[model samples]
Target: MTKPVGMEVAVAAAEAVALCNIDVAACYPITPNTHIAEHLADIIADGRIDAEYITVESEHSALSAVMGASGTGARTFTATSSQGLMYMHEILPITPAMRLPVVMGLGNRAVSGPINIWNDHSDIIMQRDSGWLSIFADNGQEAVDMFIQAFKIAEHPDVLLPINVNMDGFQLTHVVEPIVFPTQAQVNKFLPPYKPFASLHPDHPLSMGTLGLPEIYTEAVKARDVATVNAKKVIVQIWQEWEKQFGRKYEPVMTYKTAGAEILILTMGSMGETAEVAVDALRKKGVKVGLLKLKLWRPFPFDEIRKAVRGAKTLVVTDRALSYGGPGGPVCSEIRAALYDQPNRPEIVNYIIGLGGRDVRVEDFMKMIEGAPKAKKSGDAYQIYGVRE
Candidate 1:
């Protein structure tokens, strides 16, 4: 039986992982993400879930341990945030290259320099090309739901790759909401026991993660690239299956009031809800504005993006992370590139907002939308919202 209960998003995420019957959880303590690892430890300590919680020395070791466990065919899980994720940078690319289907819960936070701990997309954005299937959750419900769906998507025979379920640090992670949890039987039915395509066993001896010489290095990387792109099919299939059973539909690009609108506001992560409120207010005032929330970050969702912005004249793209020295933001740059060859593409106005846990209010969204027309052109530059003079 599925039950709805008010819970903190971090706890709810840990609960979702517990329901998946993961075999090993090796996570280090990091801000915003610590609660998840702590709760997982409690669950294992309480014997609620028969899983091994490996205590590691650092975030690097945390990922390394999970990799070894996953290589041994264990259903592995891990969680991290901010610098912790950066610490795992070396292992990030290796995991996908080795085709390990490890699932991780990323509490999205700002990367350090002056040392701040808060909500932002900078952390995850740093690993954009690491070849992990990244998905963002707009709220607590989506966070819980995506964690459960991640295993199925990653372990699919067609897509044996790692996945990162991203939720805003402090914004989505620490907040409490009414999250619906599927029953153990329901989870079991949806996600059967993970059957590894290959494993490290003594009897069936086979080499894994062997050195890639110069001759085959290009082909090796090409194979991984193709695999990442093709994983979209399995991801959608798993999402559809989840909807069929749980009644919550998910798509790569989730739209709100986009029909027949000439202007669209694009956002990712938890700010989508805030943008939705702005959209409703603008619509009430007879503005033809809509909201497009990106859920699937990697593999880029090119077709859905093209379809969503088809008739819009202007697209206001809000990015939480700034792409230094390059385009205004990573997402805005990608959106421009995706629509470059399209027939009638909209003018993109990029704004890097809510960096380092800055609050982005509904009125701020409204101001951005209202002021977008007068803002600089698509390639001119990006505006940093709410910066003090």
Candidate 2:
């Protein structure tokens, strides 16, 4: 059994990638995300992992290189942050359309305008419609475990799609934590060598990512959508297998102290951990408050969310990214749509918080929970927490 070791989450994620024995990693350095690629490069340089580390010029080139490599049946990996992710936007949809299972470690960061280098969901939320399976980690251990599981889910025969394992920029990436690194043998058992369902080889030449003419463009898009929605089954199956092998269970929607609760707060990423503390404190004070942490983002877990929010009188949905001129935050909008038709659906209140790595303490979560009822009564779509006039 491998013992827990003190390691930075970024390095631990690199180690996890190494354990998977990927064929190639196309990387470009960006803040917070740089450490992951740097460590992976060091591992490759030291001959610890026999993988090709391609130092690309930009995030666009990095993803493009991985797409080309993955097309040739290579188990490809990559990492990027806010603006870097934006650079790869052009090729993002193409990778999934071609059914390439390239796994990416997205160091979640704020998008640039004011040029902030901090943690937020803005980067990942922007790519929500990119047709990739996206999952979030609340801590370092989850980050490591999710990286290992990502490849398996992406490379599954029934689900040949790319995936993004998102970890908060500085919050989770730069922090040191005691993480249990699974032995290479254990990882090998959990995630076997990736076997591509199709490959671009001269021996048996086939076309991929070709122009979808007006004749079949809609059909082609529909097919990709079907494949993405269908991937949830394979994703769950892989997660269950990982749990059986490693004893760490993962679910789409995770609940805390939710039994008999009248009000619940919903969150994603690392903020869930802070919300749990608030839930415990409120529970001790005879308040009926629970917490829901969403792990799976793409192919959103509609059923699981409805079940979790059932019987609750109110749900305070927190968003780390804003929707700008839209209804509210992207997350709040999705939750509202998910619970719209359900009978006896709880009142969903939206609170935008923790953008650009702003500190969201336990008191903040407590305040949200305590103030949810009034917020719902006010009839406002959403409120940005801690915003100054």
Candidate 3:
């Protein structure tokens, strides 16, 4: 085990990528996410990590370059945030469709309206169905740990898919924390050298990215979807192995003090940490509330989420992203769908908060939990929290 060292989360992530010994990195500058790319570029330039770092003109090109490099059997990486992620949107679904295991770091930021750069899940959640395996890190250590797990999970023989580790933009990315660095040998044992399932080469004479004709396109899409769904098994296996080796456990849906609680708050990304604190404070006040943090985004973690809030009578889902004119927020919509058919499911409510760098304090969370029932009784499916009176 290596000693814990203090550093910015972005810096620690860059170091983790270096340890993985990726073959190439295509990057573009975006707020909050630029630091990770900058640090990686520095390490490569310093001759510390032997990898090709390409500074592309746009996020689209950044992902395109990695797609090409990854097709040639390279362990590829990229980093972006908000608009950069949206710019790369055209190429996101293609990665998993082609089964290229490219690992990316998504600096979670708010989508622009009046234009803002701050910590929010709108950027990543906007691309929820992008066919990539997504994970959220609560803190810097979890950030470090997940990056290592991501490469392994993405490249697993059964799960050849792209993965994204989403950390709160400035909240986690720029914030410094004590991170326990994984030893080089430990990483080597955990993540093996890249052995691609198929590579583009002259001798092989393989046709890569052939047109998906209408005749077989539906089947092609179905195959891609199935592959992603089945990847859950591999994700669980890899995380279990990681827990055995590192003594840090991870789950798709993690619960905090749910026992004997009648109300539960659901959260994603690093916001769960704040929600957990609120749960504790409310518990001390005899509020009988608990918290559930969702770590996995795609493949939706339906079973785990269902299990987490089984006994609760009410569910308040805190969403960092708004669905605008839709029923509720994106995550809340999914939760509703997941619990729709259950006979004894809790009355679910969604409260949208922390959009575009807004702060989510413990008191605010308590207010949401306390007010959701009344809001639900008013026939509103969701309520936006924290609007000025």
Candidate 4:
């Protein structure tokens, strides 16, 4: 086991990418995510890793360049957040449709019309149906471990889909924490060199992201959907391997203190850790409140979620992003859909919180849990937590 050392989470992400021995990194600077690319550039420049670092003028160009590099059989990486992710949306779906196994580090931030640079899942949620697998990191170790696992999952022959590893902007990104930087030998054992399923070559030319006619378009989309949904198998296999190598295990839906909890609050991203505090406090007062965290977002782990929330009477799901005019947050909506057919599903409560860097505390989680039953009985769909009167 490598000794733990204090490092910024973004730097550790760069280090994780370096350890994967990526061949190219296309980078453009953007708020909260710039450090990742900057550190990667430094890694390449300092000879810590052998990679061609391409500095692009915008996030669109950055991801486009990375996509092209991956098309050429190069293991590529890039980082972006908020508006940067939005700017790259045009090419986002193309990556997975072409089956390019590019990995990205997403500094999860709120997209802006008024321009705010803080932590939220809005940017990532907007790209949810873009055919990319999404994973959330709750802390520094998770950020590092998931990135290392992502390349393996994305490059696997059965998957060959791009993945975005999301770290909450400013919350997890800017924090300096003690993280275990595994040795090159350890990483090499965990992550084999990336092997592209297909490559763009002049000698062996292939068409990618081609126009689909009305008759073929639907089938092509179905093919991508099948590939993405099936990616969960590879994700699980990779996580299992990561566990064996590092003694750290990750699941699609992870739980804490749900043994006999009547009320459970579900969360995603870094908020899970904060909610743990409330879970502990509530358990102390003899309130059967537990916490459930969704680590994997894409291909929506339906069975795992259904299994995790089993036997709970009330489920309070907290989302960091809003759907605006919709029923509730993205997570709560998905959870409801997943549990729709269950014979004994809990009464789900949806809460939208922490948008545009809004602070949410342990007490807030407790209140949400306490208010869930009333919200359910009142026939309200969901409530925006901490909204001003």
- Model-by-model lDDT, in order? 0.94, 0.93, 0.91, 0.91
* Model 1: residue 38 alpha-carbon error in angstroms: 0.1
Best-first order by TM-score? 2, 1, 3, 4
Root-mean-square deviation of each candidate, in angstroms? 1.0, 0.8, 1.0, 1.0
| Model 2 residue 53 CA deviation in Å | 0.7
Over 1-389, each residue of candidate 3 has an lDDT whose tens digit, in order, gives 87889899998999999999999999998999989999999999999978899989999999999999999999999999999999999999999989999999989999888699998888998888888899999999999999999999999999999999999999899999999988999999999998999999998979778898999999999898888999988998999999999999999988899998899999998888888888988888999999999888887888888888899999999899888799998888988888888888999888889989999998888898888789779888888889786
Q: Estimate each model's TM-score.
A: 0.99, 0.99, 0.98, 0.98
Write out the backbone clash pairs for model 3: none
lDDT of 1 at 311: 91
lDDT by residue (1-389, candidate 2, tens digit) is: 67899999999999999999998999999997999999999999999988899988999999999999999999999999999999999999888999999999989999997899999999999999999999999999999999999999999888899999999999999999999999877888888888888889999999887888899999988998998999888888888898888898899999999999999899999989999999999999999999999999998999889999999999999999998899999998989999999989998889999999999999999998888888888899999988897
lDDT of 1 by residue, 1-389 (tens): 45679999999999999999999999998998999999999999999999999999999999999999999999999999999999999999999999999999999999997688999999999999999999999999999999999999999889999999999999999998998889889999999888899899999999888999999999999999999999998898899999999999999999999998999999999999999999999999999999999999997999999999989999999999998899789999999999999989998899999999999999999999999988854356799989997
Candidate 2 similarity to native, TM-score: 0.99
TM-score of 3: 0.98
Model 2, residue 281: distance off in Å is 0.7
Judged by whole-model lDDT over C-alpha atoms, candidate 2 comes out at: 0.93
lDDT of model 4 at position 136: 94
How many pairs of residues collide in each model?
0, 0, 0, 0
